[model samples]
Structure formats: structure tokens, C-alpha cells
Target: MSDEVKVSDAEALRFHAEGRPGKLAIAPTKPLDTARDLSLAYSPGVAAPCLEIFRDPNLVFDYTSRGNLVAIVSNGTAVLGLGNLGALGAKPVMEGK
Candidate 1:
């Protein structure tokens, strides 16, 4: 068995360009349909957690998206099978275009 994978440029382009136009999306983890949900997500309700986090930084995981976030550090010098696209040139690739 060969350990190589192949994808046509047109296929890759079509896959990324379809639907939302990106490989990632952000959405509210909690219910935000009601006014109460909105309030709890911001302003008066958010202030309480903010104060708590200020007092103890460890609470960040419980109060925010820090725990679910992942960092992908890349300068865009090299892209998958595309050689060097440079930073600006690679922006589209990074953005899933």
C-alpha cells in the first residue's frame, strides 16, 4: 500500500469554496435565542464571571472558550503540496479558499 494521498487542485478549490467558504466556523455553545440567553452571554451576567476571573485566572476555562480553542501557528511559507505561497499568497489557502 502506498502512503500517498492525492487531491486535484480543482477538487480542493471546490471543496473549500462550497457552502460557508471555510473549514472552520464559530457558533454560540449556549442557547442564545432568548433575551435571557443574550443577557447571560453579555453585560450584567458576563460581568459577574469577569470579576471572578479577575480574582482567579484559573476560572477562565470555565467562563470562556479558552479550553476549546486550539492554536495553529503558521507563517504560510509552505502549504500542503502547493510549495511556498508566501504569507499574503497563502492567506486564501489558510482561510480555506
Candidate 2:
């Protein structure tokens, strides 16, 4: 068998459109299955961690995914091929899809 197969431009576009643009998927770090899990992730159960973070400030990393996250901040200027989108137009391609 060959190590690689080829795809047409149209097929690639279809895959990109159907899946995430950057192929980046964001799933929950914690489970949300039962009613208890739901409450803990959102409401009363979450309050405790919020309080702890408010008290310590640094606990946000431990309780949330912030520690392992990277925000893609851009001015929308200098997008490849379509240059100088100026924030508004640049948002759609910000993920480098």
C-alpha cells in the first residue's frame, strides 16, 4: 500500500468546512454526564472553585483550562494573500484554516 493518497481541492474544502477550520477541537476537561455533574460544572458546584480563585487568584489555572490555553490575538492586519483585513474581516481566517 502507498504511504499517502491525494485529495482534490474540492474535497479538501469539504473536509475543512465539515470539520473545525483549524482542526482544533475544544472538549470539556471534566465530564458532564449526570445531573450532579451538570450542577457542579455550571452552578452551585462551580461557585466553590470560583470563590477559591477569587481568594487566591492563581487557582484559576488549576481549576480551569487557562493554564493550558493560548489565545490567538491578532490585529487583523497582514493576513496572507488577503492582507490588511483590519480586525473585522480577519476574524474568519484567524485560525489559519
Candidate 3:
């Protein structure tokens, strides 16, 4: 039973090496197999919303991830404990958060 926590650079490197590629991915939610699907997903039908969005910037949130994504950028020159570990060491917390 101890409150202290300690980790080394080797351990961090090992953890990163053991994982699936960086953590996130994009996947299409709907089927795009037929000509209709292609039209709807990519060209003529898609342009309907694109035009709407072109007219109103607020539609960017509706048509894309602009509303939900929050980016946190930092350098480890001023990170928690383990002082000045640089950007690489600070990545896990940034991704997790």
C-alpha cells in the first residue's frame, strides 16, 4: 500500500510499442455498394448539403466533426512531475484525455 507512483522511459516506450496503432480510426457507418449509394454518399446528393453548408457555416457542425472535437496541444517542457519529458512522454495523457 503506497501512494507513490514511478515509471521509467523504457516502460513508456514498451507500452507504446505494445498497442494497436495509436488508438483511433474512422469507419464508414453506412453501406456504399450500389450506384444509388455512391450518388448519395459522394456526388450529386452530397452536394445538396454541401451547398447548404456553403451558405451557412453552422452546418459544418451538422455535416462534420467541427462540433465535438476538442484539441489539446502541449509541450512537456512544463508537464506534470517527471520534469521536462518532452512531447513524446506527454502523449499518453493527451490521447487518454
Candidate 4:
């Protein structure tokens, strides 16, 4: 890659500061355009599955995104051979992953 194509420190900082600070966002998997959809996605219609999951804990994977989602957690004490860098310093690295 050429030097001009590489991201500079100022560009990296500006990219994060432009709109939302973080790189992650949540989006609904089901339609939520109507009141019925809202009810199904949120309240009364959601209760059936909630009750099922309550009855069987394993149903949580079927009813929720838990099966597909992954969470990466770290204290930032050790990162990619950089040594103990701490949490704030690790934010960019974690987001990249």
C-alpha cells in the first residue's frame, strides 16, 4: 500500500469523532414498522417466547441472537505483543477484530 492510502493519526481520530464514537451498532432482525410488529417484537407477542425460554434455558439460543453473536472482552492488560496497554488503548484493536 502507498503512503497516501494509509490512514494517518488525524484521519483515524476524525473518523471516530465524526458521528458516533464507536464502531458497533445494533439493528433489529424482524420488521417493526407497524403496531402489531412492535407488539410482537417488544411486548405482548414477545411474552410467549420469553415464557418458553423460562421453561427451558436452552431455548434461549433458539429465541435470541445468542447463538450467532459473539462478545469479545478484555482487560487490555495484554494485546498482540504490545504488553499491558490497558482498556482505553485496546478499544481500537478490539473494534478492528
Query: Pick by TM-score: which candidate is best?
Result: 1
Best by lDDT: 4
Clashes of each: 0, 0, 0, 0
Looking at model 4, residue 63 earns an lDDT score of 92
State which candidate, 2 or 4, has the greater lDDT.
Answer: 4
Question: lDDT (CA) for every model shown?
Answer: 0.83, 0.81, 0.78, 0.88
**TM, every model:** 0.77, 0.66, 0.57, 0.66
Model 3 residue 37 lDDT score: 92
With candidate 3 superimposed using the best TM-score fit, by how many Å does residue 28's alpha carbon deviate from the native? Answer: 3.3
Put down candidate 2 lDDT per residue, 25-93, tens digits, no spaces: 788878899999999999989999999999999999889988887778788888877888898667656
Shift of residue 76 alpha carbon in model 1, Å: 2.6
Worst lDDT 10-window in candidate 3: 21-30
Top-down lDDT ranking: 4, 1, 2, 3
> What is the clash tally of candidate 4?
0
Model 1: how far residue 27 lies from native, Å: 1.0
Error of 1 at 31 (Å): 1.2
**Which regions of candidate 2 fall more than 4 Å away from where they truly are?**
1-15, 18-22, 86-93
Tell me the tens digit of each residue's lDDT in model 3 across 6-70.
88989866876676745455677568889999898888878987898999989988886678678
Cα RMSD, each candidate: 2.8, 5.2, 3.9, 3.8
